[model samples]
Target: MRRLDLPPVWLLLFALAVLVLSRLDPWSLRLEGAAVDLAAGLLIGGGALLVAVAVVQMRQARTAVLPRREAAHLVTNGVFGRSRNPIYLGFVMLLLGWVLRLGSAPALALVPLYAWVIERRFIRPEEEALARRFPQAFARYREATRRWL
Candidate 1:
């Protein structure tokens, strides 16, 4: 399979879709309560933090940091030390937050579809490349970190 790179455009589009699908129609299911807002904020904050950590780790590794690509070095330290796919994790968190804020059940359904599409289209190819590039190191890292958390 070709490289499974998801460009910024596609990521943004997916994010937008999640937001739209989950948006609360004030007339339907009003989400004006502070509790829901707090939960949404926490989710958004967590997502941002995860993404930031991933970016910092990539910079430290001196790698391209694209989901469709493999790092020149197997980054098994820092944020990578904990999760194999921090960026994806962040996106998933963001999706959950979006759904919470919108109070939409349909939005939750998209979460599985998003995960499946990403795993099949992007993650697998990147893993294969990483294995070829850093076989031993990648294996060790894989053994240590969970693919998703």
Candidate 2:
């Protein structure tokens, strides 16, 4: 794992960017009402649960949480069975919730960008390592579980 390649750090940067971009008056979508608030809350809460579950599984397996690091074993059950990168997926969900909460059309742009960056900078490399480390299992898992869901 690269010492400086932190997923959460990037999440914070993107979140701050969303907040800053949401302030631009010209591009405001200005979504309002209880529905928006409830949706945002659900997304945020679900994202946190995903992250928490993924982390707990990794820790229980005695594997490295950081990307591109050596893994003790392949995680293919629970939340991982749904997505190869649950933590990153959770991060994107959190970003989407922020976009909805901010109600800015322009802020929504960064949500996909965040996913793209994480996929390019972290997920791809981590997958490469996992493939090399656990070839058959990785292939099976990749086929069964999507990179993102």
Candidate 3:
């Protein structure tokens, strides 16, 4: 059997797990305000926008978007300028949005869990590779940008 090797695949798996758990919301916690709904909608939209911008920037730079591959260039402009791992940040935002939408306090735990998994599984390794590939530039970029914002 092939290994489930990609970060996105892992993210999707965790998301699915969160979805399943949300169905079993034990405390029955819920936010019953239009403002809460608005916040959730904003998070969903912003997360999607961040992911889209990151992908587009990667494509324009002719760099590999997947963390497993070597990047062709160090992307530090646009969304990349704001967060070193905008894609991963986007994923976290998406999870948060889902948790909010579901109104599940238990599901909120998955957001941090997803972040931990992505950081350990993908971001750290990718950063190591980038440091090796573009030592000076990567150092400067790392110093300038937050990992997640």
Candidate 4:
């Protein structure tokens, strides 16, 4: 069976849940305003930019971008130097943007859950792979870098 459990899959599902919860709104808590729109726009834009930069960096290193895959190189420069898991961090930013767009309490709450899932499913495994593949370098990198930022 194919591994359907992935970050993008959960991102989409959580986004859809945000939409549904926005409408159902059992909590009746909604955020609305011009500021909210501006914040959402910024988060979405920043997240997209961050993901793009990280993907480009990984590709330049000739490393795998997907989770639970072997990487050819240990990329510890550019955005990677800033955050160890910038892609997942970007994904969370995107989910936060979606929550703000939906403007529901339940929607906002899902962002952390999405982060947790990505960390458990992707980040941890990816880190282990990196540690195995580039033991000394990864140990140094991990010590200097934060997992998420």
Clashing pairs in 2: none
Cα lDDT tens digits, model 2, 35-140, are 9889899889999999999999999999999876799999999999999999999999999998889877778779989999999999998999999999999999
Candidate 1 vs candidate 4: the lDDT winner is 4
- Per-residue CA lDDT of model 3 for 1-149, tens digit only, reads 12577767877887788778878767776655787788888888999899999999999999999767899999999999989999989888887887787666787788888899889988999999999999999999999999997
**What tens-digit string does per-residue lDDT give for candidate 4 at 1-149?**
24778788889998998898899997799889999989999999999999999999999999999887889999999999999999998999998988887788667878888888888878888899899999999999999999997
TM, every model? 0.82, 0.95, 0.93, 0.96
C-alpha lDDT values of all predictions = 0.75, 0.90, 0.85, 0.90
Which residue pairs collide, candidate 3? none
- Estimate the Cα RMSD of every predicted model relative to the unseen true structure: 3.3, 1.5, 1.4, 1.1
The 10-residue segment of model 1 with minimum total lDDT is 1-10
The TM-score, computed over Cα atoms with residue i paired to residue i, of candidate 2 is: 0.95
Off by over 4 Å in 2: none
Clashing pairs in 1: none
Q: Rank the candidate models, highest lDDT first.
A: 2, 4, 3, 1
| Model 4 weakest lDDT span, ten residues long | 1-10
Q: Is candidate 1 or candidate 3 better by TM-score?
A: 3
